[model samples]
Target: MAERIRTLTGHLVRHTGKKSPDVQNVSGNLSPAVQSSFRYTLENPLKTLTKNQRNFYEENGYLVIKYLVPVSALQSYRKRFAEICNGECTVPGLTVMKDVALAKSSPIQGEKAVVKIQDFQYDDALFQYCCLPQIIRYVENFTGPNIMAMHTMLINKPPDLGKKTSRHPVHQDLHYFPFRPADRIVCSWTAMEKVHRQNGCLVVVPGSHQGDLKPHSYPKWEGGVNKMYHGITNFDPTLPMVHLEMDPGDTVFFHPLLIHGSGTNRTDSFRKAISCHYASTDCHFIDIAGTSQENLAEEVIDLAVKRTGLPREDIQFKDIWTLKSRCVKGEQNHLQGY
Candidate 1:
């Protein structure tokens, strides 16, 4: 118990986030049953999920579909990533390493300074992977037949001596989204290579999505990225979390509301993963004002105001969602807005 407390405290200090005292208690000493219940897994063939697979996802908020992507597909992804790293790709969405001198001057240094290619779907290879037949079939289990690829990211975690930016603070995916019917929203996170505890693999709390969205805020880490997104500010310490260790082609389909994050890549090599957030066209955009969604919206809008020099009042939830969204599958329903 003391060791766990120390672990949590260390994570809190290093991550630049705050957790309420009550939330911390959840992680305190407890029996094995409590911890075991928090870790779960359901596996099925790559083509689609079985009946039990859907049940496990409903009960636990996540499903791990092994070998969903063939090795050849992963090889293609690797080639694309290599091209971006080697400066061979001039694609607009590829996030390139910035000038070393300028990057080093920032408060966050070393591996914590990893770059992410946002909306990499703009690239041909990634776009195909986003709509891969196997992936789409798995997503249909949650979103029915109508699915839209709402977000995509290729996160490159640089090796870190201190495991700093290599890890993300625990948070819910829906917090960053303005859409509703969260139950219909899912994420397919595919491991591009071997991912394990030492390489900062994802960690998630089972059944965390069964409740409403929780509060989130930026961690107070000094010298951190200025525009970083908010994360769960408080959580029950007792909630069991599993460190997702996967090999290439193993993908996890998860609920948007699940409390999840990753550790730092302690190894010498960089860890890469490609993920897409999918939502049903049946979902609708909701007004964030005067709602639980207000906090995150305010943070996002504030950044926009600073970046574009626009007034906060002029910004609407719909505007933000539209700017960040791209329809990859079915048509987007415009009428489902506040």
Candidate 2:
């Protein structure tokens, strides 16, 4: 445990937006380095989680479980968040609603956020919240102890403000991240309250991780910016879209490539969630500059683009972390290799 903490501290000091391995997997194209890391991650996944975790990721691309954060932690976090927002506590580098991008220079297409804090050190709640034994167990069950906090933020959907809501554009986490050994990376989406439909519950296109990555535009929120899934309409209309109505402590594990977005917060209460991404120590970076990997690797098959049982263009993996997930007429999906 001490070694993991020490290594992660080193990683944190050197951390940038992307920290994947040099040989990474982006929709089945394998750089030799990524292949080795993939093998290592596979061999020790059970060491971090039970057999159930491996099965969970294989079937669902993520694990939606709990105990990642405790109720007391949430309460303390909520108070601190409020204090910062209200200007009662002032941090030298923190940004609040006052720093929102002015309407005169509105950079995005929707209502701006009320607060955006960057480089938020989790000394108070985040450390304890993220390092919980249950949470560590789940991660250990997969990637061993080589983990670091990628990023943190606060996106408050205050009902009184009636923030204009729209889909946050669908795209894989790898598109913007582009790290090596992409397969070892994981994300945890934890909620701060009851995330209901009216309160902007996150909607996910389950199993969409098996297909191609679509084009997208990112928006600047708080003090940070990230990719948003929009402009790409290449999904199977038949597959059921799922909305995760999560509670305060529940979190959703998902592949970075899954298709997901949230609706407007029409309800009276606030709905918020913290999404943190982690990866194994050996994740690699790829050499996409000169490989046939420009298109989805031949091994990473997409049911929609292949048109095996139906139309050929039905499935496709157009972007970095894409897959052909929509199979036809009760056909079984066997993700061969990527």
Candidate 3:
């Protein structure tokens, strides 16, 4: 059955204009030959990235492209976010989350109070970011022609309210994912404004993607940690970190295993960015139980129970991801199993 699935997936990729030689079998454990063929970076010809750019990503686990998004489009997204916060618009399946510090303190209303919005695939305006031609062009280089936008977020890093709760803990993105062949997944984060250290820009450890997924849990901080904000328990503090200060429309595409986090927003305003995690439709979900991802999966299931008032047994972790994922390009093959 597994071999049959791979054959069908390979045929699908060929029909979609992607070279079959670049396709990997999506079933069972990857053999050494397959693993060697699908390196951290693609060896085949790229659609948008130059050879130097591809080499940079291979060595550093990330690549930054300046002015990859239009300022006008970002402004439009900002307006839509404000409308959603002000209760002027409703988007089904969207989650509006407030900063943990602000949630405890005096209630500040509107967009300023909300820290981020998740699962915005149902919102046409914001979801357009995932389908941007410029983005997909680069994304196809990493995830191939058949792609699925597995996750979406518009982060609003609110100014710290003296508690330093606005800072996200350093962790790997794969900690929250239950997918295999981690090389097939990539995240594109675009700044919605000028982001600097003072305003909590992204801090990344270069070449971290070559490492294995580390164990993670909530960091112990005086200010309460936000729901689902897990941190690497054994993160090597001595490892060199780079602060990614980006202007509006500057975008970075990174591997899932890259260790990264942001500083507190010391500035008085919000630091905003939009991002989507894309994976090859050829990638398949894995059982996360008894693994480092188990804790997060349990938390997500618990949250689902509270939100939907459903029986705990009915809401599996994979089901949550299956419902959230949407195909951005080509056929949705292996990833659709719920």
Candidate topping lDDT: 3
At residue 181, give the lDDT of candidate 1. Answer: 80
lDDT agreement of model 2 with the native: 0.48
**Structural similarity to truth (TM-score) of each candidate:** 0.75, 0.60, 0.88
lDDT, candidate 3, residue 276? 97
Q: Who is ahead in lDDT, 2 or 3?
A: 3
lDDT per residue as tens, model 2, 246-321: 7788877777667677766676655666555655545443544334343333333242233233323332233212
Q: Count the backbone clashes (under 3 Å) in each candidate.
A: 6, 37, 0
Candidate 1 vs 2: which has more lDDT? 1
Error of 2 at 277 (Å): 1.0
User: Which residue ranges in model 2 land beyond 4 Å of their true spot?
Assistant: 1-53, 89-118, 121-124, 160-163, 218-239, 285-338
Worst 10 residues of 1 by lDDT: 18-27
The per-prediction CA RMSD against the true structure, in angstroms, equals 14.2, 14.3, 7.7
Q: What's the lDDT for all of these models?
A: 0.66, 0.48, 0.83
The best candidate by TM-score is 3
Could you give the candidate ranking by TM-score, starting with the highest?
A: 3, 1, 2
- TM-score of model 3 vs. true structure: 0.88
**After best superposition, candidate 2 residue 76: deviation in angstroms?**
1.5
